[model samples]
Target: MFDLSKEFESFYKNKVVLPNDKQNDLREKKNLNISRLKDGLNEYNEENKTDYKIINTIVQGSMAMHTVVQNDSNDYDIDVAIIFEKENLNDKGPLAVRNIVTNALKRKCENFKKEPEVKTNCVRIEYQDGYHVDFAIYRRYKKENESEYTYEHAGSEWTLRDPKAINNWFKDEIKDKGQCLRKVIRFSKMFCKSRDYWVNMPGGLIQTVLCDEKIQNSYERIDEIFYHTMVEVKNRLDNDINVYNPTDTSLSLLSTKDHEKKVENFKNKLNDKLKKLDVLFESDCDKSKAKNAWYEFFNHDYWKEDTSNEKVQKYSSCYRNTEEFIEDLVNINEQYYVTVSCNVEANGFRLQPIKKLLRSLPKGWLPHGFSIKFNVEDTNVPKPYNIWWKVRNVGEIAQKRDMIRGQIEKHVGNCKQEHSDFFGNHYVECYIIKDNVCVAIDHIDVPIE
Candidate 1:
């Protein structure tokens, strides 16, 4: 049997988990926001003569648990619980408390590009660059015999919810399953992120629940863990079971009315991935097949090549040459075009330009000179860039004339080469090189007549 355990492990490490640098960047941003929130609240209380004291602020959700995936779009959603002293709730309702926090942030966050939006349960501050920070107001009652915290919910009601409790529960569960559990959850999340149907279907908490229940030390391989976990999740959804929050059992994670449709979609996506996993597992000794299966499953380019020995190459700079510059003045005001026509015979294939055929030339004939043009957009970079043209004979017929591939003038973008001597297929490639690195490339295949 084919084993993809090592591949899966590598994928998880490289693709699923966010890099340390990115994680640190997120942490720094979150801390900065937290500090601003505290300062904002303190200033608001002093300005309005309100006794609303910000006791503490706690980071919750995937940010705290370290299960967040690196989003290319920079839409990382952060959840922060803004805990206030119990005295703040003695005279104010949930909405009032929420508004106080929201107003404070709006007044204090003058440096932000956009104003903070007051949502039902949290104040959302969106940054121009992309990520957003959500501040959920919570009133902490530290009195003896009734020490607890109540969070704003539904704009008016105060609900008993503990963000730290859920985070702690997830941490304990991860400890029990060893480090693999976190990897499994992150991999599952990565799978969800790879597809559109599963994007918003399975949330972080729901995925955590599924992994905790299904991946009970049954298998050691990452692929097996993924398969079993997804299978169990599908079974649960098929049976119309509700996954409750570990912190609050009464609150069902899948409580929306449209959850049935969402669950059905999740099941369909899971089934498709499971089929691909089976294919990879059965593709023993077939490295290409296994890689293709993984590519299909992950829908990412990280698995496309082996890069263990490859060194990183950095280009100093790159720019495009404007089309008008190359088309009008560069070509000496002469219009250039290429035409291709193909004819298939029993023994060989022949390609010809329409101009040659229109002239009623003999069979297996070729054009005397083939002109190819290259151009690019305008750039602010100073001049003196090199342009190179590469032509190769790619036809089936052997003993054809040699192809030409060489550098042209900096301002020259047109290539009028002799093609009448060759009889087979040909390809022309153009590149703009700077500092020994190619900044732009274009290619076209030459067809024989």
Candidate 2:
């Protein structure tokens, strides 16, 4: 496929994936909205002489699933579930409950140019800067005093729903299926949302369901997997546009005529793009042509744009004196999927996962000098496999210090311990060999600040 792996990784990292700064901003905005909602509800209760109170609030949807992509319009959406005790509401209809939440938002969030409005299923508060929050109201009541509480969402009628069901479903898929699926879903979303012309396109949840249903996992690079997965999903959609909820098969996510129209449009467009990628399978296809094909598919220049001078300089500095290639030292077979994760420890105290710490900090980096223990967290390969570890360090500090370690070594256990000695985008890769053939592989990059 012309090996556009580097290009795809760069595009996904720089364009499709939301930056850490944007993620932090979204989290702050969501937190502010929640605070306002709760405070407004309190004000509503005091002014109306009512006892309405919020029992629970949960962030759901794409934000909760961590599949949110960078959009051109900056139109980020946050879905939250606002739950209350049914007895507190005294038997209110769906619209009535929505109205209460809308009024509460109106009372506290007066800065919005567009006021909080009650939708059929949620109360939406739109910010002037293009961010919106959807609060899905739900009520819980005990059928019998001794029985557990039953949850019902305030839809047209009170419909049974577990607010966390969809999120849990995606989590389970990631846990069992593979992490690559999450990246595929994000890339598909980026493609579907690349241009604003397709206004009727399926939303993130629907798109996620589609990807889950027709995902194509492979040992090939992520770019290839995404291309084939999009084709598979389009074929599936052509067969049927009805997308059932992953949490509940009985409920269809595409319940409206507009949703069906959106899926049809998406399927047709994807078909057209997949036809453009036919050049990829040709023997004469080269890197430039393959990337251009991807550009055509995504309708984005990220695929076609030349590497920036800054990136070139960064790469030159990192690799100017590097002589080791991990692949040259070991046989690499990606047949069985494996995932590696690490724990950051300081002063004998295990703090948190390295990736989690990096996401919480700026620039996807961690403090130097922390001890790291990388573990083979998940794998589908059978037991009795040989494990190999490689720690590669890059950056001016590492290069000047004469510590650019890139050796592949056999490890004694599933966990490999190392310390952050200097600044660099250091990474640890684990290779699993079964019967002298590398069966699975995974790597986790740890950027030292």
lDDT of each: 0.60, 0.79
lDDT of 1 at 14: 54
lDDT of 1 by residue, 1-449 (tens): 35677677657655766754465466567667777777887788788776667766667777666677753347677888877766655757777777777777776677676898888778899887788898887766644676554443324477767646776686567656765667677777777778654554657777777778777466877777776777777777677657787877788887685764555666778877767766655535476677777778778786686543333111101211111111111211001112222222222323434344435656544443443333343332234555555445443232222222222335344343434345555544454555443334344445555
Backbone clashes in each candidate structure, one number apiece? Answer: 8, 0
Error of 2 at 425 (Å): 17
Question: Which candidate number would show the highest TM-score if scored against the true structure?
Answer: 2
Stretches off by above 4 angstroms in model 2 are 145-147, 308-449
TM-score for candidate 2, please give it. 0.71
- Provide the global lDDT of candidate 1 against the true structure: 0.60
True-vs-predicted CA distance for residue 311, candidate 2, Å: 7.7
